[model samples]
Target: MRHQIASVDADHTSYLYEWKLNGRWNKLGATVNSDFVPMKPGSAEEFILEHYWAITGEAMLTRWNTRWSMCHGV
Candidate 1:
């Protein structure tokens, strides 16, 4: 299984959307907008990790968390 950063918004507010799947198109939940702050640094990694636990299905958390923690030390 793998994860992808689908989209991000940083104009006025910092918001991110991530799509997680195993060689297929599967949608995971999105992260809550972290309020609007101009000139703030954006982090795709932070966005994905923040919302990874809320992904759809039962085992998504286990699969994603295990992989993420292993590689990124989450």
Candidate 2:
């Protein structure tokens, strides 16, 4: 994997329609593959993908936690 330091250029949300990955807007029913697969039992995907939360405005003090389902399949 290539690593570089730059400002975040994407947006993430609970709904797939509002998500932007890799600097491209994700439309409904669109899919993108990545090398970052969740490992057995506990892995990085769990902590990163399991929960949805947002914080914004005024020094980013306010945060909203959104509930969603976690899917595990191959």
Candidate 3:
């Protein structure tokens, strides 16, 4: 319920007075070197990429009234 959002500087420190809130104090004045590169998780990427396929399969199964039982190895 924040009426106004405070901006953070390049150092990642919020202008709000509570620096220790949500571990902000620990991450303050930190820097990421040039070697820092971002990449997506493989499982997440696969799930996101195959979302349409999952939906299509569900639609097809529903239309055909197919029943599926999945096996989980204990």
lDDT of 3: 0.31
* Backbone-clash count (model 2): 0
Error of 1 at 48 (Å): 20
Candidate 2 versus truth, CA RMSD in Å, comes to 15.1
Model 3 lDDT at residue 40: 35
lDDT of 2 by residue, 1-74 (tens): 12223322243233333344676544432223222332333443333443443322341322233334433221
Per model, how many backbone clashes are there?
A: 0, 0, 0
Which segments of candidate 2 are over 4 A away from where they belong?
Answer: 1-14, 17-59
lDDT scores for all predictions? 0.35, 0.33, 0.31
Model 2 Cα displacement at 48 (Å)? Answer: 9.9
Compose the digit string of candidate 1's lDDT tens values, residues 46-67: 4453476454443232221111
TM-score of each: 0.22, 0.22, 0.18
Scanning candidate 3 in windows of ten residues, the lowest lDDT window is 65-74
**lDDT (0-100) at residue 54 of candidate 3?**
61
Runs in model 1 deviating more than 4 A are 11-26, 36-74
Residue-by-residue lDDT tens digits, candidate 3, 1-74? 12222334442322212134453332222222223233334554345445655643433322221123322221
